[model samples]
Target: MTVTAADTVPAATLEPPTGRLSPLQQWWVLTTRGLLKVFRNGEFIFAFVSPALLAICFYLPLREAVAQVATIDYAQYLMPVIMLQSAAFVASSASMRAAVDGQEGVHTRFRVMPMPTAVPFLARAATNFVLLLVALACGLITCLIMGWRPVPEEYGGGVTGAAIAVLLVAMIGMALTLCADGIGLVAKSPEATSQLVAFPTLILGMLSTGFIPLNQFPEWIQGFVEYQPISQVTKAMRDAIGGILDWQRFEPTLWWTLGLFAVAAVLLVLGTRKAAR
Candidate 1:
């Protein structure tokens, strides 16, 4: 039988799950479903291949030329941003997944089910986090293949050094995912959400210090390049690995990241209300 929205239970019944699984368990069930969809759609392979491809595409043509400009091996200079490219990919994937759910009225159905209010958000976040981690691993392996290492003076001081850099990058990746997921909910279609995010990702990724250094940019725009979020993250990760990360350089980016998280939270609240209606 075809059931209309009027036939569905009210949001009151969606109160936190009671008997079967705890709220946490209910959330995990949805999370597992999201993860399975990702795997079945072959996003897993793309998640791995996209980062490696970014590393290769940038490293091949510009290595020698950029080496002279940055005064470091181009591979080392390009390393952080390469991982960032992967992070962006993961963020995009988050949007696609959320948009799919929204379009299919999955959020609407969940709202009427007997689960906690936060379950949908948590389930989406859990799936995105796992995929982001996988993307990070793929990016690391790709960088290593192209000559990035934890050399004390160069790449990283070893595990400790790499950890610091990775932590910062992970935080940024999570923040981006939050915003993208919100966008997906609002857009309510996979294609729409993906299209909406592409411009910002392309502009920020290219116009920042990801591929080219600050000095390489025009004098007038150099400040913008230095201050942008992507450049800040790339600089933070690079400095951490090199054992030079400090409050001064990282502080602004931290603030920007926090602001982004706040924006995402507000958007999510609004989106949930929209889905409920």
Candidate 2:
């Protein structure tokens, strides 16, 4: 019997080159794919829209209303919360991406492929990080147009201090993206992940100093409003931007960032294990 060319072939040769790509290459490929999806799906269009909405909807109406009592620059005050909100945006999108991948069999395909375990998750995170930056940049521009300036008059850290503050916000955002990935992996459905994420983000954003100054809150819940993780982050970011970061205000925020790292790590393990099973 003639085996022909088909029988002579080692079948493995036709398989995808998962093994051929180095870890960095794999990460890059996955990152690019994620970014492409973000661009093509038009997810980022809303990133721009949100900042505009926040700028006009909340900023315009609330500016003078808050000033009558507080004497604070509302745009500057709202900027940190706006930036932090972008972090949550990235996380929600990350979870959605994870759910879509699982729903579409991309996760299953990754399991069968011979790639590092971290590649898939990290790639998604990296993509989210990029989007986070873009979203925040858009938010920053909107805030600036609304008269939010990063002048270091209070903290006296000046331009350098302002840069550090931005860096800190960016770092916090990266950490949040990781946390989102963990949640995404565990929930395994975009809808569940978004619902899971929305509660804390909303509660914290509303209650935190980023939205309303701590002193402005009612006496009863002021303690929680002051020390909650989002509040701490917002306060620290505000001080950092103002060039007024002293060790006292900086320490707790650092610890909170570390805590988020731990949460992300644990979730990643649990979600990956479930996927493997």
CA RMSD, predictions in order: 7.1, 3.2
**Model 1 Cα lDDT, one tens digit per residue, 58-142:** 8988888887766787777788888888888988999888888888898899999888879989999999999999999988888
lDDT of 1 at 149: 80
Candidate 2 lDDT score relative to the true structure: 0.82
Residue 270 C-alpha lDDT in model 1: 83
TM-score of 2: 0.90
Candidate 1 lDDT trough over 10 residues, lowest sum: 151-160
Instruction: Itemize residue pairs with steric clashes in candidate 1.
Output: 150-156
Q: Estimate the TM-score of every prediction.
A: 0.90, 0.90
Candidate 2 regions exceeding 4 Å error are: 1-19, 152-155
Angstrom error of the Cα, residue 35, model 1: value is: 1.0
Clash count for each candidate, listed in order shown: 1, 2
* lDDT assessment of candidate 1: 0.86
